[model samples]
Target: MLNLKQIVAGYGPAQVLHGVSLDVPRGRVSALLGANGAGKTTLMRVLAGLVRPQSGSVEHEGREITALPAPRRVGLGIAMSPEGRMVFPTLTVEENLQLGAIHARARRGYRERREEMYALFPRLAERRRQTAGSMSGGEQQMLAIARALMARPDVLLLDEPTLGLAPVMVKQIFEVVQRLKEGGLTMFIAEQNVRQTLEIADHAYVLENGRVQLEGSGAALINDAGVRRAYLGM
Candidate 1:
Protein backbone atom coordinates (compact mmCIF):
# COMPACT_ATOMS: atom_id res chain seq x y z
CA MET A 1 0.00 0.00 0.00
CA LEU A 2 3.08 2.21 -0.04
CA ASN A 3 5.12 3.13 -3.10
CA LEU A 4 8.33 5.01 -3.78
CA LYS A 5 9.41 6.23 -7.20
CA GLN A 6 12.90 7.41 -8.13
CA ILE A 7 13.54 8.55 -4.56
CA VAL A 8 16.81 10.47 -4.26
CA ALA A 9 17.77 11.41 -0.69
CA GLY A 10 20.81 12.13 1.50
CA TYR A 11 22.28 14.29 4.23
CA GLY A 12 24.01 17.49 3.04
CA PRO A 13 25.76 16.83 -0.32
CA ALA A 14 26.47 13.10 0.09
CA GLN A 15 23.65 11.40 -1.76
CA VAL A 16 22.90 7.84 -0.66
CA LEU A 17 19.85 6.69 -2.62
CA HIS A 18 20.04 7.18 -6.35
CA GLY A 19 16.52 6.97 -7.66
CA VAL A 20 15.63 3.98 -5.48
CA SER A 21 12.12 2.72 -6.02
CA LEU A 22 10.07 -0.07 -4.40
CA ASP A 23 6.57 -1.09 -3.46
CA VAL A 24 5.09 -2.40 -0.20
CA PRO A 25 1.80 -4.12 -0.86
CA ARG A 26 -0.90 -4.14 1.79
CA GLY A 27 -0.72 -6.89 4.45
CA ARG A 28 2.60 -8.14 3.14
CA VAL A 29 6.13 -8.09 4.47
CA SER A 30 8.64 -6.42 2.14
CA ALA A 31 12.31 -7.01 2.93
CA LEU A 32 15.15 -4.67 1.95
CA LEU A 33 18.38 -6.65 2.29
CA GLY A 34 21.84 -5.13 2.15
CA ALA A 35 25.06 -4.88 4.05
CA ASN A 36 26.34 -1.68 5.63
CA GLY A 37 25.88 1.60 3.70
CA ALA A 38 23.55 0.24 1.07
CA GLY A 39 21.03 3.04 1.77
CA LYS A 40 18.63 0.70 3.54
CA THR A 41 18.31 2.93 6.59
CA THR A 42 18.20 6.07 4.44
CA LEU A 43 15.35 4.66 2.40
CA MET A 44 13.43 3.79 5.57
CA ARG A 45 13.93 7.34 6.85
CA VAL A 46 12.64 8.76 3.59
CA LEU A 47 9.57 6.53 3.80
CA ALA A 48 8.93 7.58 7.38
CA GLY A 49 9.12 11.27 6.39
CA LEU A 50 12.14 11.73 8.66
CA VAL A 51 14.23 12.70 5.62
CA ARG A 52 12.74 14.76 2.81
CA PRO A 53 13.64 13.49 -0.62
CA GLN A 54 15.40 15.76 -3.06
CA SER A 55 13.31 14.27 -5.86
CA GLY A 56 10.70 11.59 -6.68
CA SER A 57 7.62 10.73 -4.70
CA VAL A 58 6.25 8.53 -1.90
CA GLU A 59 2.62 7.49 -2.18
CA HIS A 60 0.61 5.73 0.50
CA GLU A 61 -2.53 3.97 -0.71
CA GLY A 62 -2.74 6.65 -3.47
CA ARG A 63 -1.90 9.90 -1.69
CA GLU A 64 1.46 11.61 -2.12
CA ILE A 65 3.27 12.12 1.20
CA THR A 66 6.83 12.97 0.19
CA ALA A 67 6.59 16.48 1.50
CA LEU A 68 4.81 15.59 4.71
CA PRO A 69 6.67 15.93 8.03
CA ALA A 70 7.54 12.93 10.20
CA PRO A 71 4.87 13.51 12.82
CA ARG A 72 2.30 13.98 10.09
CA ARG A 73 3.33 10.66 8.59
CA VAL A 74 2.89 8.99 11.96
CA GLY A 75 -0.60 10.40 12.04
CA LEU A 76 -1.12 8.85 8.60
CA GLY A 77 -0.41 5.35 9.97
CA ILE A 78 3.34 5.20 9.40
CA ALA A 79 5.47 4.37 12.43
CA MET A 80 9.20 3.64 12.45
CA SER A 81 11.23 1.79 15.02
CA PRO A 82 14.66 3.15 14.17
CA GLU A 83 17.95 1.21 13.88
CA GLY A 84 19.42 1.88 17.29
CA ARG A 85 16.41 1.13 19.47
CA MET A 86 16.36 4.75 20.59
CA VAL A 87 14.21 4.42 23.65
CA PHE A 88 14.10 7.02 26.40
CA PRO A 89 16.53 5.65 28.94
CA THR A 90 15.05 7.55 31.84
CA LEU A 91 11.45 6.76 31.09
CA THR A 92 9.66 3.78 32.50
CA VAL A 93 8.47 1.10 30.02
CA GLU A 94 4.86 2.17 30.46
CA GLU A 95 5.79 5.84 30.17
CA ASN A 96 7.58 5.27 26.87
CA LEU A 97 4.47 3.50 25.60
CA GLN A 98 2.39 6.45 26.79
CA LEU A 99 4.60 8.80 24.79
CA GLY A 100 4.07 6.65 21.73
CA ALA A 101 0.30 7.17 22.01
CA ILE A 102 0.62 10.94 22.47
CA HIS A 103 -1.11 11.47 19.15
CA ALA A 104 -4.86 11.85 19.52
CA ARG A 105 -5.70 8.96 17.23
CA ALA A 106 -3.58 6.56 19.26
CA ARG A 107 -4.77 7.97 22.55
CA ARG A 108 -8.40 7.02 21.87
CA GLY A 109 -7.99 3.57 23.47
CA TYR A 110 -4.67 3.89 25.19
CA ARG A 111 -5.36 1.53 28.03
CA GLU A 112 -6.66 -1.25 25.84
CA ARG A 113 -3.85 -0.83 23.33
CA ARG A 114 -1.25 -0.88 26.07
CA GLU A 115 -2.73 -4.16 27.27
CA GLU A 116 -2.54 -5.56 23.78
CA MET A 117 1.11 -4.58 23.54
CA TYR A 118 1.69 -6.13 26.93
CA ALA A 119 0.11 -9.33 25.70
CA LEU A 120 2.34 -9.24 22.67
CA PHE A 121 5.30 -8.71 24.96
CA PRO A 122 4.71 -10.22 28.38
CA ARG A 123 8.27 -9.32 29.44
CA LEU A 124 7.35 -5.66 29.10
CA ALA A 125 4.32 -6.21 31.29
CA GLU A 126 6.50 -7.68 34.02
CA ARG A 127 8.84 -4.72 33.87
CA ARG A 128 6.29 -2.04 33.17
CA ARG A 129 7.62 0.35 35.77
CA GLN A 130 11.32 -0.27 35.09
CA THR A 131 13.49 2.34 33.38
CA ALA A 132 14.36 1.60 29.77
CA GLY A 133 18.08 2.26 30.20
CA SER A 134 18.54 -0.67 32.56
CA MET A 135 16.98 -3.21 30.23
CA SER A 136 18.96 -5.72 28.21
CA GLY A 137 19.56 -5.11 24.52
CA GLY A 138 16.96 -7.73 23.59
CA GLU A 139 14.46 -6.22 25.98
CA GLN A 140 15.23 -2.75 24.64
CA GLN A 141 14.59 -3.91 21.09
CA MET A 142 11.29 -5.40 22.18
CA LEU A 143 10.43 -2.10 23.83
CA ALA A 144 11.30 -0.17 20.68
CA ILE A 145 9.03 -2.33 18.53
CA ALA A 146 6.30 -2.27 21.18
CA ARG A 147 6.48 1.50 21.48
CA ALA A 148 6.04 1.92 17.73
CA LEU A 149 3.11 -0.51 17.73
CA MET A 150 1.50 1.68 20.39
CA ALA A 151 0.72 4.11 17.56
CA ARG A 152 -1.39 1.43 15.85
CA PRO A 153 0.27 2.06 12.51
CA ASP A 154 -0.93 0.71 9.18
CA VAL A 155 2.60 0.09 7.95
CA LEU A 156 5.49 -0.40 10.35
CA LEU A 157 9.03 0.46 9.27
CA LEU A 158 11.45 -1.76 11.17
CA ASP A 159 15.08 -0.82 10.57
CA GLU A 160 17.67 -3.35 11.76
CA PRO A 161 15.50 -4.64 14.55
CA THR A 162 17.93 -7.43 15.26
CA LEU A 163 21.16 -5.52 14.97
CA GLY A 164 23.70 -6.39 17.68
CA LEU A 165 21.42 -8.69 19.60
CA ALA A 166 22.33 -12.18 20.77
CA PRO A 167 21.50 -15.07 18.42
CA VAL A 168 18.63 -16.25 20.64
CA MET A 169 17.28 -12.74 20.85
CA VAL A 170 17.48 -12.43 17.10
CA LYS A 171 15.40 -15.58 16.78
CA GLN A 172 12.82 -14.23 19.23
CA ILE A 173 12.63 -10.90 17.40
CA PHE A 174 12.04 -12.67 14.10
CA GLU A 175 9.34 -14.78 15.75
CA VAL A 176 7.63 -11.60 16.87
CA VAL A 177 7.82 -10.26 13.32
CA GLN A 178 6.34 -13.51 12.06
CA ARG A 179 3.42 -13.12 14.45
CA LEU A 180 2.85 -9.58 13.26
CA LYS A 181 2.84 -10.80 9.68
CA GLU A 182 0.29 -13.51 10.56
CA GLY A 183 -1.88 -10.79 12.10
CA GLY A 184 -1.78 -8.97 8.75
CA LEU A 185 0.57 -6.11 9.57
CA THR A 186 2.12 -4.44 6.54
CA MET A 187 5.82 -4.08 7.23
CA PHE A 188 8.95 -2.82 5.49
CA ILE A 189 11.99 -4.29 7.18
CA ALA A 190 15.58 -3.21 6.45
CA GLU A 191 17.84 -6.03 7.52
CA GLN A 192 21.20 -7.76 7.07
CA ASN A 193 19.86 -11.11 8.27
CA VAL A 194 18.83 -12.54 4.94
CA ARG A 195 17.68 -16.10 5.69
CA GLN A 196 15.16 -15.37 8.42
CA THR A 197 13.97 -12.23 6.69
CA LEU A 198 13.32 -13.97 3.39
CA GLU A 199 11.57 -16.79 5.20
CA ILE A 200 8.81 -14.39 6.24
CA ALA A 201 8.97 -11.80 3.44
CA ASP A 202 6.41 -11.93 0.68
CA HIS A 203 8.65 -9.83 -1.58
CA ALA A 204 12.31 -8.94 -1.18
CA TYR A 205 14.76 -6.42 -2.62
CA VAL A 206 18.51 -6.52 -2.59
CA LEU A 207 19.91 -3.01 -2.30
CA GLU A 208 23.47 -2.06 -3.09
CA ASN A 209 25.25 1.29 -3.34
CA GLY A 210 21.92 3.09 -2.91
CA ARG A 211 20.02 1.31 -5.67
CA VAL A 212 17.91 -1.80 -6.06
CA GLN A 213 20.11 -4.53 -7.50
CA LEU A 214 17.52 -7.28 -7.41
CA GLU A 215 13.82 -7.71 -6.62
CA GLY A 216 11.67 -10.81 -6.52
CA SER A 217 9.37 -13.00 -4.52
CA GLY A 218 11.02 -14.09 -1.29
CA ALA A 219 10.90 -17.77 -2.18
CA ALA A 220 12.38 -17.08 -5.58
CA LEU A 221 15.24 -15.03 -4.21
CA ILE A 222 16.05 -17.56 -1.51
CA ASN A 223 17.14 -20.09 -4.13
CA ASP A 224 18.72 -17.54 -6.46
CA ALA A 225 22.37 -18.36 -7.23
CA GLY A 226 23.43 -14.75 -6.85
CA VAL A 227 21.63 -14.35 -3.52
CA ARG A 228 22.93 -17.63 -2.12
CA ARG A 229 26.49 -16.92 -3.26
CA ALA A 230 26.56 -13.32 -2.13
CA TYR A 231 24.60 -13.53 1.11
CA LEU A 232 23.92 -17.09 2.18
CA GLY A 233 27.31 -18.45 1.06
CA MET A 234 25.70 -21.39 -0.65
Candidate 2:
Protein backbone atom coordinates (compact mmCIF):
# COMPACT_ATOMS: atom_id res chain seq x y z
CA MET A 1 0.00 0.00 0.00
CA LEU A 2 3.03 2.21 0.57
CA ASN A 3 6.29 2.39 -1.36
CA LEU A 4 9.37 4.44 -0.51
CA LYS A 5 12.26 4.54 -2.95
CA GLN A 6 15.67 6.11 -2.57
CA ILE A 7 14.46 8.16 0.39
CA VAL A 8 17.29 10.56 1.24
CA ALA A 9 16.25 12.67 4.20
CA GLY A 10 17.59 14.10 7.43
CA TYR A 11 17.82 17.16 9.61
CA GLY A 12 19.82 20.10 8.21
CA PRO A 13 22.79 19.05 6.03
CA ALA A 14 23.14 15.56 7.48
CA GLN A 15 21.43 13.07 5.19
CA VAL A 16 20.39 10.02 7.19
CA LEU A 17 18.67 7.84 4.59
CA HIS A 18 20.72 7.24 1.49
CA GLY A 19 18.98 5.33 -1.28
CA VAL A 20 16.64 3.66 1.18
CA SER A 21 13.80 1.57 -0.26
CA LEU A 22 11.01 -0.46 1.30
CA ASP A 23 7.47 -1.61 0.59
CA VAL A 24 4.49 -2.06 2.85
CA PRO A 25 1.74 -4.17 1.33
CA ARG A 26 -1.92 -3.94 2.16
CA GLY A 27 -3.37 -5.95 5.05
CA ARG A 28 -0.09 -6.69 6.76
CA VAL A 29 2.13 -5.32 9.47
CA SER A 30 5.57 -4.36 8.17
CA ALA A 31 8.11 -4.02 10.94
CA LEU A 32 10.96 -1.52 10.55
CA LEU A 33 13.63 -2.44 13.08
CA GLY A 34 16.77 -0.53 13.84
CA ALA A 35 18.79 0.60 16.78
CA ASN A 36 18.93 4.32 17.58
CA GLY A 37 20.15 6.65 14.79
CA ALA A 38 19.38 4.11 12.12
CA GLY A 39 17.00 6.48 10.29
CA LYS A 40 13.93 4.49 11.34
CA THR A 41 12.14 7.51 12.73
CA THR A 42 13.38 9.67 9.87
CA LEU A 43 11.78 7.29 7.40
CA MET A 44 8.47 7.48 9.24
CA ARG A 45 8.65 11.26 9.32
CA VAL A 46 9.20 11.37 5.58
CA LEU A 47 6.20 9.12 5.06
CA ALA A 48 4.06 11.29 7.35
CA GLY A 49 4.99 14.43 5.37
CA LEU A 50 6.41 16.09 8.50
CA VAL A 51 9.93 15.96 7.02
CA ARG A 52 10.23 16.27 3.30
CA PRO A 53 12.71 13.94 1.68
CA GLN A 54 15.74 15.52 0.13
CA SER A 55 15.24 13.36 -2.96
CA GLY A 56 12.87 10.42 -3.25
CA SER A 57 9.31 9.43 -3.90
CA VAL A 58 6.61 8.10 -1.58
CA GLU A 59 3.60 6.57 -3.28
CA HIS A 60 0.42 5.41 -1.62
CA GLU A 61 -1.90 3.09 -3.49
CA GLY A 62 -0.07 3.97 -6.70
CA ARG A 63 -0.63 7.71 -6.20
CA GLU A 64 2.35 10.01 -5.80
CA ILE A 65 2.06 11.87 -2.51
CA THR A 66 5.63 12.92 -1.90
CA ALA A 67 5.04 16.62 -2.41
CA LEU A 68 1.76 16.80 -0.55
CA PRO A 69 1.60 18.64 2.76
CA ALA A 70 1.24 16.79 6.08
CA PRO A 71 -2.44 17.55 6.39
CA ARG A 72 -3.08 16.12 2.93
CA ARG A 73 -1.22 12.99 3.88
CA VAL A 74 -3.43 12.64 6.92
CA GLY A 75 -6.37 13.13 4.63
CA LEU A 76 -5.08 10.30 2.50
CA GLY A 77 -5.33 8.00 5.52
CA ILE A 78 -1.81 8.08 6.87
CA ALA A 79 -1.21 8.83 10.53
CA MET A 80 1.92 8.59 12.62
CA SER A 81 2.06 8.15 16.37
CA PRO A 82 5.49 9.63 16.92
CA GLU A 83 8.26 8.38 19.17
CA GLY A 84 7.60 10.54 22.24
CA ARG A 85 3.87 9.81 22.48
CA MET A 86 3.13 13.46 21.70
CA VAL A 87 -0.31 14.14 23.11
CA PHE A 88 -1.63 17.52 24.14
CA PRO A 89 -0.76 17.54 27.83
CA THR A 90 -3.20 20.15 29.04
CA LEU A 91 -6.13 18.79 27.01
CA THR A 92 -8.56 16.24 28.31
CA VAL A 93 -8.27 12.74 26.87
CA GLU A 94 -11.36 13.40 24.80
CA GLU A 95 -10.00 16.71 23.63
CA ASN A 96 -6.69 15.16 22.66
CA LEU A 97 -8.50 12.48 20.71
CA GLN A 98 -10.74 15.05 19.13
CA LEU A 99 -7.70 16.75 17.70
CA GLY A 100 -7.00 13.73 15.52
CA ALA A 101 -10.30 14.07 13.76
CA ILE A 102 -9.07 16.98 11.69
CA HIS A 103 -9.43 15.00 8.51
CA ALA A 104 -12.63 15.90 6.69
CA ARG A 105 -13.73 12.29 6.28
CA ALA A 106 -12.78 11.47 9.83
CA ARG A 107 -14.72 14.42 11.19
CA ARG A 108 -17.86 12.99 9.60
CA GLY A 109 -17.48 9.89 11.73
CA TYR A 110 -16.33 11.61 14.88
CA ARG A 111 -18.97 10.41 17.31
CA GLU A 112 -18.80 6.83 16.13
CA ARG A 113 -15.01 6.91 16.13
CA ARG A 114 -14.94 8.36 19.61
CA GLU A 115 -17.01 5.50 20.91
CA GLU A 116 -14.87 3.06 19.00
CA MET A 117 -11.78 4.58 20.52
CA TYR A 118 -13.28 4.23 23.95
CA ALA A 119 -14.08 0.61 23.22
CA LEU A 120 -10.64 -0.10 21.84
CA PHE A 121 -9.14 1.49 24.93
CA PRO A 122 -11.34 1.12 27.98
CA ARG A 123 -8.67 2.68 30.16
CA LEU A 124 -8.96 5.85 28.15
CA ALA A 125 -12.74 5.72 28.48
CA GLU A 126 -12.40 5.66 32.25
CA ARG A 127 -10.43 8.90 32.12
CA ARG A 128 -11.88 10.51 28.99
CA ARG A 129 -12.56 13.75 30.83
CA GLN A 130 -9.21 13.76 32.67
CA THR A 131 -6.28 15.84 31.51
CA ALA A 132 -3.66 13.94 29.45
CA GLY A 133 -0.72 15.09 31.58
CA SER A 134 -2.32 13.59 34.66
CA MET A 135 -2.24 10.10 33.22
CA SER A 136 0.54 7.65 33.90
CA GLY A 137 3.20 7.07 31.24
CA GLY A 138 1.52 3.90 30.05
CA GLU A 139 -1.89 5.52 30.04
CA GLN A 140 -0.46 8.46 28.16
CA GLN A 141 0.94 6.09 25.59
CA MET A 142 -2.45 4.49 25.26
CA LEU A 143 -4.00 7.89 24.80
CA ALA A 144 -1.49 8.73 22.10
CA ILE A 145 -2.30 5.60 20.11
CA ALA A 146 -6.00 6.05 20.76
CA ARG A 147 -5.85 9.58 19.44
CA ALA A 148 -4.03 8.38 16.35
CA LEU A 149 -6.72 5.77 15.83
CA MET A 150 -9.25 8.54 15.97
CA ALA A 151 -7.98 9.52 12.56
CA ARG A 152 -9.10 6.12 11.23
CA PRO A 153 -6.07 5.79 9.08
CA ASP A 154 -5.53 3.16 6.41
CA VAL A 155 -1.82 2.88 7.02
CA LEU A 156 -0.77 3.82 10.57
CA LEU A 157 2.89 4.50 11.19
CA LEU A 158 3.70 3.54 14.76
CA ASP A 159 7.08 4.65 16.09
CA GLU A 160 8.43 3.20 19.32
CA PRO A 161 5.03 2.15 20.61
CA THR A 162 6.62 0.40 23.55
CA LEU A 163 9.40 2.86 24.27
CA GLY A 164 9.40 3.40 28.03
CA LEU A 165 6.36 1.49 29.19
CA ALA A 166 6.35 -1.35 31.67
CA PRO A 167 6.15 -4.87 30.28
CA VAL A 168 2.42 -5.08 31.01
CA MET A 169 1.62 -1.91 29.14
CA VAL A 170 3.81 -2.94 26.27
CA LYS A 171 1.92 -6.17 26.11
CA GLN A 172 -1.35 -4.25 26.04
CA ILE A 173 -0.17 -2.00 23.22
CA PHE A 174 1.08 -4.92 21.18
CA GLU A 175 -2.19 -6.71 21.72
CA VAL A 176 -3.99 -3.69 20.34
CA VAL A 177 -1.69 -3.70 17.33
CA GLN A 178 -2.33 -7.37 16.79
CA ARG A 179 -6.05 -6.73 16.89
CA LEU A 180 -5.64 -3.97 14.36
CA LYS A 181 -3.62 -6.24 12.14
CA GLU A 182 -6.33 -8.87 12.38
CA GLY A 183 -8.78 -6.21 11.33
CA GLY A 184 -6.62 -5.78 8.20
CA LEU A 185 -5.15 -2.39 8.92
CA THR A 186 -1.92 -1.88 7.05
CA MET A 187 0.79 -0.64 9.40
CA PHE A 188 4.44 0.29 9.41
CA ILE A 189 5.68 -0.28 12.94
CA ALA A 190 9.05 1.03 14.11
CA GLU A 191 9.91 -0.90 17.20
CA GLN A 192 12.93 -1.75 19.38
CA ASN A 193 11.03 -4.64 20.88
CA VAL A 194 12.28 -7.18 18.36
CA ARG A 195 10.85 -10.44 19.65
CA GLN A 196 7.30 -9.21 19.84
CA THR A 197 7.48 -7.28 16.58
CA LEU A 198 8.62 -10.34 14.67
CA GLU A 199 6.00 -12.49 16.29
CA ILE A 200 3.20 -10.27 15.03
CA ALA A 201 4.62 -8.92 11.80
CA ASP A 202 4.10 -10.41 8.35
CA HIS A 203 7.23 -8.87 6.83
CA ALA A 204 10.20 -7.10 8.41
CA TYR A 205 12.97 -4.77 7.32
CA VAL A 206 16.10 -4.17 9.33
CA LEU A 207 17.54 -0.69 8.96
CA GLU A 208 21.18 0.07 9.58
CA ASN A 209 23.23 3.19 8.95
CA GLY A 210 20.18 4.76 7.26
CA ARG A 211 19.47 1.95 4.81
CA VAL A 212 17.63 -1.32 4.79
CA GLN A 213 20.19 -4.09 5.29
CA LEU A 214 17.77 -6.97 5.54
CA GLU A 215 14.21 -7.46 4.34
CA GLY A 216 12.27 -10.69 4.64
CA SER A 217 9.46 -12.48 6.34
CA GLY A 218 9.32 -11.61 10.00
CA ALA A 219 9.90 -15.23 11.02
CA ALA A 220 12.77 -15.56 8.58
CA LEU A 221 14.49 -12.42 9.78
CA ILE A 222 13.85 -13.34 13.39
CA ASN A 223 15.85 -16.53 13.01
CA ASP A 224 18.56 -15.05 10.81
CA ALA A 225 22.00 -14.85 12.38
CA GLY A 226 22.53 -11.18 11.47
CA VAL A 227 19.23 -10.01 12.91
CA ARG A 228 19.71 -12.13 16.01
CA ARG A 229 23.19 -10.74 16.60
CA ALA A 230 22.38 -7.10 15.85
CA TYR A 231 18.90 -6.62 17.25
CA LEU A 232 18.01 -9.34 19.76
CA GLY A 233 21.40 -9.16 21.50
CA MET A 234 21.18 -12.92 21.74
> For residues 29-103, what per-residue lDDT tens digits would candidate 2 score against the true structure?
999999899999999999999989989899999998889998888888899899999999999999999998977
lDDT of 2 at 14: 95
lDDT of each: 0.95, 0.92
On the 0 to 100 scale, the lDDT of residue 97 in model 2 is 91
How much does candidate 1 score in TM-score? 0.99
lDDT of 1 by residue, 1-234 (tens): 899999999999999999998999999999999979999999999999988999999999989999999998889999999999999999999999999999877999999999999999999999999999999999999999999999999999999999999999999999999999999999999988899999999999999999999999999999999999999989
| Model 2 weakest lDDT span, ten residues long | 100-109
Q: Which stretches of candidate 2 lie over 4 Å from their true place?
A: none
What are the runs in model 1 whose C-alpha is more than 4 Å off? none
